[model samples]
Target: MTAELLEFLEELSRALIASGNSVTDTERILWSVAESQGVEVEVSVLPTMIIIKAEGEVSRMGLAAQSPGMMPLHQVTEIYRLTDDVTSRRMEVGEALGELRGI
Candidate 1:
């Protein structure tokens, strides 16, 4: 479960960055999602990369292949909605991942 959550966070971080979120906003979202799930994660994000560390043998560093760019407004809205659902525990990690892929 830790690994799955970590993977989900890494992907979420990438998505947030790629969708033009600032590093600070991205970090806040990551922390909120992790904390809401009752997990402790160390997250660091730059314009080009993100690092996530957690217990239970989960660690990930994700590098962006390109610069951050704007996504469509609807896509950005979906991402925020997803984040909200996760933080509120209305969506499980697995289900969030599936929904994220669709975004």
Candidate 2:
């Protein structure tokens, strides 16, 4: 699972850069985010990004634009955290997303 996650992160990082996006400090942030989710493995840092794979069961998280997309990690992270059985580390994704005013 860790291997798959790192691989995906590396690929996603490349894709993000190819499309022109700054990933500065993203590795740490992503690791935190992943832990916030239910990903129990360590997020290994690749050349450009961090990787952590989904384990056991994988859920198709969709996007919020209602464009027929899978739910994004940000949306399901808290649920994952809850699933991980940690009751005190919840992050209100909806609230945080609501604060993204101009983006």
Candidate 3:
């Protein structure tokens, strides 16, 4: 589950950044989503990469390559929707990953 959570977080951060969200906004969203799952995460979002450190019984760090870019308004909206679903627990990690990838 932790591994899945890390993968989901990385994907979510990348999507947010590519949608033109600022680092602060991305961090807040990640924190919210992690909190919903009762996980503590330290996330760093940059134009070139996203780094996430999850603290728990077994702590781990994951990185996802990111490139600075902007998406269409509709695509950005879809990404936000998926993020809301994850933060609200309306979607599971696997489901959210699929949805994010689809967007």
Model 1 C-alpha lDDT per residue in residues 43-71, reported as the tens digit of each score = 99998889999865657998955544567
Give me the runs in candidate 2 sitting further than 4 Å from their true place: 25-29, 36-103
**lDDT tens readout by residue for model 3, 1-103:** 7788888888888788777788889889988998899888887777657778888534444454555455789989999888888888888989999888888
Tell me, by lDDT, which candidate is best.
1
lDDT of candidates 1 onward, in order:
0.86, 0.39, 0.81
**Collision count for each candidate, in order:** 0, 6, 0
Q: Which sections of candidate 3 miss by over 4 Å?
A: 56-69
Instruction: Give the candidate order by descending TM-score.
Output: 1, 3, 2
Local lDDT at 61 for model 2: 28
- Superposition TM-score, candidate 3 onto the true structure: 0.85
Best by TM-score: 1
Model 1 lDDT vs. the true structure?
0.86
At residue 38, give the lDDT of candidate 2.
Answer: 49
Root-mean-square deviation of candidate 1: 1.6
Clashes of 1: 0
**What is every candidate's alpha-carbon RMSD to the true fold?**
1.6, 11.0, 2.3
TM-score winner between candidates 2 and 3: 3
